[model samples]
Target: MANELDGRVAVVTGGASGIGRGIVERFAAEGAKVVIADVQDELGEALASQAGPDALFHHTDVGDQEQIGELVATAVERFGALDVMVNNAGISSPLRRGLFTEDLTEFDRVMRVNLLSVMAGTRDAGRYMAEHGGGSIINLSSIGGIQAGGGVPVYRASKAAILHFTKCAAIELAHYDIRVNCIAPGNIPTPILQSSATGEDRERLERFEARIRAQMRDDRPLKRDGTPEDVAEAALYLATERSRYVTGIVLPVEGGTIAGKVMARKAGSEIPANGAPS
Candidate 1:
């Protein structure tokens, strides 16, 4: 495993924390020179330093297209190449009582950060990889995009868009040998949800999260929470030659939740459609 990614260069957006952090650490340990990108300068820098000389922190607001372009240039310039591009930085849409209580105020920010950033990162990385030997591009999506239900509609919409966009990018970038894929994680408890909500949304989000956790005892198939490392394992596969022939696909790291609960099969049973812990 340590030699699997030797000589590779990877960029993980939102690498400061959560699933992105797991990928960064995993890639670095596996011998890849990793670039950590995030607006959290403190966390990003600390993680980069901890990862040693082969890793560097690049303060980037992925929501900004110009910044994303600059990030690609910086990665190529610093690392000398961009072998793996992971557009994993994302923000959750505010949770609300229901659709009626939703004002859609976070629409712009959510789309820009969650959706547009992936699009730009792929294009920018694809452009470079297309010329200097194509590479792997992995996008972070959520099961919320896969299953339909309530709360965080914008977040789900943005993720769903990433799924379709990844496929389209894969088709076009395939000419250059760039393999594009996606990871859809669920029930992985990251601070992302709490980090996204504030004020009244906080209380509501807490209760909602508690309910999900309680239900996981009997509802989810595995009945265990997922971790960033779980999703990172999937990422590690896609980044290396192991998935060379794979492209334009979504890999779910969910604990069989995506497959649906099987113990108590009932008609009209509902699955949670909110954004994931990843």
Candidate 2:
């Protein structure tokens, strides 16, 4: 897969860390000129430097539609073309005791960052791709959006919105050759969870996160935690021509977490009658 994306240009929002950083690194390794857009200037710049001349960092706040427009334009100006746009910047809502206790404090911020940013990115990038030949746009959603959960309702809602919106955009932009898709990642440890908690709440969040991770491992069919690199691999597929016929699809990179609970059975267990293990 090396150099699969050679001569392409990509803009990855939230390109400094986590899955987004992994995407940037992978894209650059494949010979794409990438613009690393993120508010984390230091980390983004460091990453761009590490990626060599094929990558550049741009300080961007995806929450602002104006900034998103600028990001697209800057990518075009710097790279002379835009072939892929990855709207990966997002924020998680605070974990309240329950939905009832949620004061809806972070609703607007979460919506703007998680949902609105994707919309703006798609619109901005779609416009350019429409006039130009065409391109791929990848949005980052979450398994939380696919399955109903109690905590982080706002975050879930935002991501669900992205899923639907991606489909709509794909239909509309297909005529122009611009492809739109989403990647729903799950059970990947990143700083986003901790960023949503505060002092005492942070400790509670850590405990809650530990319990959830344990449950996820038990429930996951693969029984292994996903890594940023896993999601990055998905992004690479959507970015390159290998997926030329794919669009408006929601790809789940969750190690089969959303499929269903993994049937528990002993190492040498025998199948019982009625096809139910006992």
Candidate 3:
């Protein structure tokens, strides 16, 4: 897909790591001049440097609307136009015992980082795309948002909000020829997971994560873990003209985890009269 995004300009938030980094690299490879927006100066700069002249690193805290505005303007000033906007910066809420023990201390921070940033990115990017002949906006969501589960309730709510917002924005932006969509990634191991933990919690998290991964391997139909590149590929599809007709959709790059759990069966097993495997 070399040069697939020729002459295009893309801005990806949280481009310093994980899925966001993957998208930045992919976009640069496809011939798009990309702006890497993130709070991690060192990592972002290194990634931009590695991407060569087509990429630029910009320090941005998407939680601030003014900074987001600046990021959009920076892309236009440097690259001439903003053709794609990726609202990929997100943080996971800390895992707690249960709803009873939850104090919701990080509620505001999580919403600001995960939900408000996406809204601001879409609105700001849409304003530009609306007048400049339209463009694509890809928002990152998670499988946790799609399915109701325990643990990080706040994060789930924020991602669920993103899913709905993307659809609503798509409908409203359609008149302006701007496209809005979402990519919900599942079971992709990234550093973001570790960032949510501390000393004791970190140890517990590791064990919990291991158990979850083991279960996911059995539950997910594909029997394999997902990668940041998997989500990036989905973003690329939404970013380019290939999906011109597609909008207001939640694309799950979850290895069929949302489809249903894989049914276990023995090799050459036969069903008995009671419908049990023999």
TM-scores for all candidates: the values are 0.91, 0.94, 0.94
Listing every candidate in turn, what is its Cα RMSD in Å to the true structure after a full C-alpha superposition? 6.7, 2.6, 3.2
Candidate 1 stretches with Cα past 4 Å from truth are 201-207, 265-278
Clashes per model (N, Cα, C within 3 A) = 0, 0, 0
The TM-score between candidate 2 and the true structure equals: 0.94
| CA lDDT scores, all candidates in order | 0.91, 0.93, 0.93
**Candidate 3 Cα outliers beyond 4 Å, as residue runs:** 198-204, 270-278
Error of 1 at 178 (Å): 0.5
Q: Give the TM-score of candidate 3.
A: 0.94
Candidate 1: residue 248 Cα off by (Å): 0.8
Model 3, 1-278: lDDT tens digits are 56889999999999999999999999988999999999999999999999999899999999999999999999999989999999999998887788997788999999999999999999999999999999999999999899888988999999999999999999999999999999999889887666555344667878877887887788888977899998988898999999999999999998899998788777878887999777
**How far is 53's C-alpha from truth in model 3 (Å)?**
0.9
lDDT, candidate 3, equals: 0.93
Model 2 Cα lDDT, one tens digit per residue, 204-269: 878967987898889889877899999999999999889999999999999998899887677867
lDDT of 1: 0.91
